[model samples]
Target: MGAAFRARTPSLAQLFDEDMLGDDLEAWLNESFLLKRTFRTCAVIAGLIDQRHPGKEKTGRQVTVSADLIYDVLRMHEPDHILLEATRHDAATGLLDIGRLGSMLKRIKGHITHRRLDRISPLAVPVMLEIGRESVHGEAHDFLLTEAADELIIEAMGIGHTAGE
Candidate 1:
């Protein structure tokens, strides 16, 4: 937690209530797809995607694979896979790091002094606006990446044709 990183944003700060502790925090996190996203991200870092393969331009019988399918297979077959565990350990954001965050959560949950806010809060307007913004930007970014990948694939084919090897 660097002082420079602290921009005094109340968005995340306001979500915390004194009554709600670690178990609540874990529950809150479970609702998000952060685990799956982290797994994919770590998969790339772990060299599982294989974006680089020499002479890929002339590869024959190439088969396209959907990321969702791979994730489904891994999840169903090996729930406690190294990739998923690596996500918890090596993820840049450390959102699911069970070591430090889990310990802090245990300490927080130990204090069973009073009841808590069982339901969620009412920050509907801002959340929707942020989500809308993210959706637009995410779609645009994804399109740009797709375009770049298509260009690479076409260029690779051209190389194969011209070289005739």
Candidate 2:
């Protein structure tokens, strides 16, 4: 028998370790949210995590779904991100119940049209929203795209009304 060697398998926490991301991840998240209130909420939550953990690992399986990061980056004060993440995770795992996501997608489609931004061509929005929704269901991937979608609609509406004025 040749020398025995075991393939190293990184733990779930290892994959999303905070050391690998540093402040950049925080910065990116902040910029992604952009709105002063949203940014502040995210920042406060992140700071709380840092304070509570002190020297412990700040990423991994916990952070991926169960930690404050989820609230900071996705859930926070809304359920849209939670729903979207759940949908995405289900899709990635091949365990997605198409009928369920189809219904959610239908809801998303209604929102998109309501924003009047459908004219801008929203090909990827549905897919991303589905995935984002899946993430909240403890499926793979981090961060849902729901917040971005809302921001896009808010911005689009702002522009639409301004143009009319």
lDDT of 1 at 103: 61
**TM-score of candidate 1 versus the correct structure, residues matched by position:** 0.37
lDDT per residue (tens digit) for residues 55-155 in model 1 = 66634654356444566678689858887667656543465565655466555553533223445346545564555332314366788999999998999
Model 1: CA > 4 A from native: 1-14, 18-31, 50-63, 91-93, 96-165
Q: What is every candidate's alpha-carbon RMSD to the true fold?
A: 16.3, 22.5
Candidate 2: what lDDT? Answer: 0.44
**Tens digit of per-residue lDDT, candidate 2, span 1-165:** 011112214532343343544465445433332222333344445553233356776555543333344444564566465343443443334433445544655554424321234353578567656554322232222235666578889999999999999
lDDT of each: 0.56, 0.44
